[model samples]
Target chain A: MKREDLQLLQKREWCKGCGICVAFCPTKVLIIDTDDKVTIANEDACIKCRQCEQRCPDYAIFLEEASDV
Target chain B: MRSSQLVEKYFRTKNLPHIWCPGCSLGIATRSLVVAIDELGLDKNKTVIVSGIGCSSRAVGYLDFNTIHTTHGRALAFATGVKLANPELHVIVISGDGDASAIGGNHLIHAARRNIDLTLLIFNNNIYGMTGGQFSPTTPHAALGTTAPFGVVEQPFDLVKLAEGAGATYVARGTAFHVNPLVKYYKNAIEHKGFSMVETICICPTYYGRQNKSGTAVQMMHWLKDSFVLNTAYDKMPEEKRQGKHVYGEFVKKDLPEYVEEYVGIIERLKGEEDA
Candidate 1:
């Protein structure tokens, strides 16, 4: 399976509008939205680093391998 | 010769095409460590590598040494046990900032405090690179991360000083751009008698570089070259000019009884008591 098949999503309500994910992302995949929520702006660029998943204080983000779905 | 060449020599086939990103520094750090081991002429059978969860932890799987890819942030603790059980074995711990400092902070301190005969190489990329770009404990204040949208508000930890304060006999810091020095530091740490640590400030091109707009791997290398000052190089510069940049090379080295040696002493004393 292609590695990019992994998917990352943010729970907008749980997001504190913190841009920690944006700053830590090596691929610039996530971006801060107008509503102060984090969104996947460049999903294709993600290397599934999972830095955001572990560092998020609110646990607002989740990652799932595409094969699992 | 480039250290990466040595890594290719012993790399496992099953794990071909490592999981790290193209410009990720973990691979470079891993290569440097492996090459250092080979250069030191260390017996693979006598060497044991332990690692905690993270992108850097995957090094255990790629190497041919006795390896344990343990749970997140517990590599040092396991390495401590391994060394105490078999003092003849050379133990090495490969970890990332989140795995080494954040979750494994306590183990790190105690291992250094006890002066275990183990080498710890921390891949400090500032941000957590594996779980998406998130602010790690090492992330600088006002830095952007997944959790810190505006900026990281918390102060980052100085891993080298922490290890020194925790009683490590040797400590140093290097970046991927300085591969030769990094390999040298790793070799020194491995040869040291007591707990030795090298904090490698690597680049998380996929996470950290992208967020910081550091361009690409080449750009990150340029930044690293510009940010770090070798001790010898720094000594030539004005003190004021050294501010805010990492001082590379050996920071601390001293003689101290390693944990296994002290433990062996205890065992001997107990035997004497039993005889009495």
Candidate 2:
């Protein structure tokens, strides 16, 4: 499946703004905004590597319920 | 499966987001653990999680399992009793560096010597995080801590070697940066019978980082990536090139008589004698 096909979700309140996800994102798809929360800066560029999801220390960013496809 | 699904299934949702600092690697290590449990398809109802006092020990409070938040450095003692009472249940102990080595040091060695059927995961962040970043037994030599302002002069304990010397049936080390291998090690450690220990190297960016000028949280993560090498590669690297590099991998795996089974066997034998 394409990277953009996966629904990405982020819990802003849970984010502590560590930027681990932002730093580990291979495609530069995330950024810590002014509020110090992770936000999708370039969703279309995402490669679906899931590094951001895996590396996120706070569980702030993740893909929607993965299907068995 | 997706992380959200794992969280929904394995975690106490209301207790999150955890209180760990923004750059702390405890969450990552914790996630890998849940993933291992999920992949193994272990029965949540039949599993028990135990922990002692420390930053890493707080993990028990978040996990959705039969859990015990025990006294500092005594998690192994409580877990031993729990396992002996019900050997059918899977017992996993989570401990911090100071909790496992300094205060609970004797318990750790004795537990390993007994070869009890329990899994111990030590979150070795090299500092006493909960107590404000004091130097821990596993803290690297010459590293600075609140307790070691001028850097530590004493040699740090090599946890893998310690466990091996104590007679652990299964021993391995993994770091927060290498999630996949860590998950694999956790899986193996949990599945192995007799005393099993996994020393998970993690980053305590808030305390360990700030005190040592280790740069930002992101930079610390990179340092973990660059400095740590798998045991296999570490062996082949030149001695000079290996300086300052950390090694992690399965150090040992061997089966021995598990304590509970032996104790039970003795009981059964005595009962047979009485009947005769």
TM-score of every candidate's chain A: 0.82, 0.82
Off by over 4 Å in 1: A1-69, B1-5, B272-276
Candidates in order have lDDT scores of: 0.81, 0.91
TM-score on alpha carbons, each prediction: 0.76, 0.95
Query: What TM-score should be assigned to candidate 1?
Result: 0.76
- How far off is residue B224 in model 1, in Å? 0.6
Where does candidate 2 stray beyond 4 Å? Answer: A1-5, A66-69, B1-3
Candidate 1's displacement at residue A64, Å, is 41
DockQ of predicted model 1: 0.02
Model 2 collision count? 0
